[model samples]
Target: MYPISTPSHAKLLRPSALPLHDRGGGARTVALVSPALGATTFISGITEFDPGTEIPFHSHNCEESVVLFEGDAVMDIDGREYALQPLDTTFIPANVVHRFRNVSHSKPMKILWTYASPQATRTLRDNGEIRAVALEHGKQ
Candidate 1:
């Protein structure tokens, strides 16, 4: 176990410092920053999508919460689309198929993602059709 720290001992990190996985077409992700810094119970990171880029439909076993920090986001949850703007937060239950896309033509969309598990697992949908966006480094 790692030693618990006081609030003053909290660590600050930039998204670039974390392990970034390319999802192709300018979509990228960071992972495990929480546990890497001794956090327990949950893990968190960031995902950035460039204009005209998106993540393929997938489902995770763990619940997810995301906060849009920049630009515009169009989230397709269970086949329904929701438009998200800055500071908007969304919660997704486990085992739900969802995807995210950047709606802006010239701006990038960035979101902070948090998962209940340290290593969130996602199953990508493969239905004999080519995927527009690949998985992030072939991972969840």
Candidate 2:
């Protein structure tokens, strides 16, 4: 077999192919870009959020680290609120409760989330989270 650059292969994908979700609450995410590696690994693409939109308070069964690329945010984790801006990196311990909110109106929030363990994603995708019926609102 011939070899091709990873970037070349990845570029063949159209954004429309990504599975989007807004089933839970505020903000939206495209799952295909993140392409889960397993129950415990992945490099996620962009996660977009609207101004003043919050991810809602929730806890993860595993650890998560995110890098902000665009706009800014305030992360509330374990009772402390930390400001996050473009290029900022944050970490959330396993089973810890946390949330992200878009604090800018003129700019949109984008983040690169890496999961040490995608416990939630597995549940969501395996249990009809990506099913047609679960898709609400247009494309996240």
Q: Top model by lDDT, which number? A: 1
Q: What clash pairs does model 1 have?
A: none
Error of 1 at 11 (Å): 2.0
* Residue lDDT tens for model 2, 1-140: 11122654542334356556663545676553222222225434457887777765665555678888888789987778999878999887765667788988777788877666333332231232322211222322
TM-scores for the candidates:
0.77, 0.64
Cα lDDT over the full model 2: 0.59
Relative to the true structure, candidate 2 reaches a TM of 0.64
- Count of backbone collisions within predicted model 2: 0
Leading candidate by TM-score: 1
Model 1 agreement with the true structure over 13-83: per-residue lDDT tens digits: 65555567876678877653455566666777788888878877887778989899999899998668999
Model 2 ranges off by over 4 Å = 1-19, 23-26, 32-40, 121-140
lDDT of 2 at 42: 43
Write down the worst ten-residue block by lDDT for model 1.
Answer: 130-139
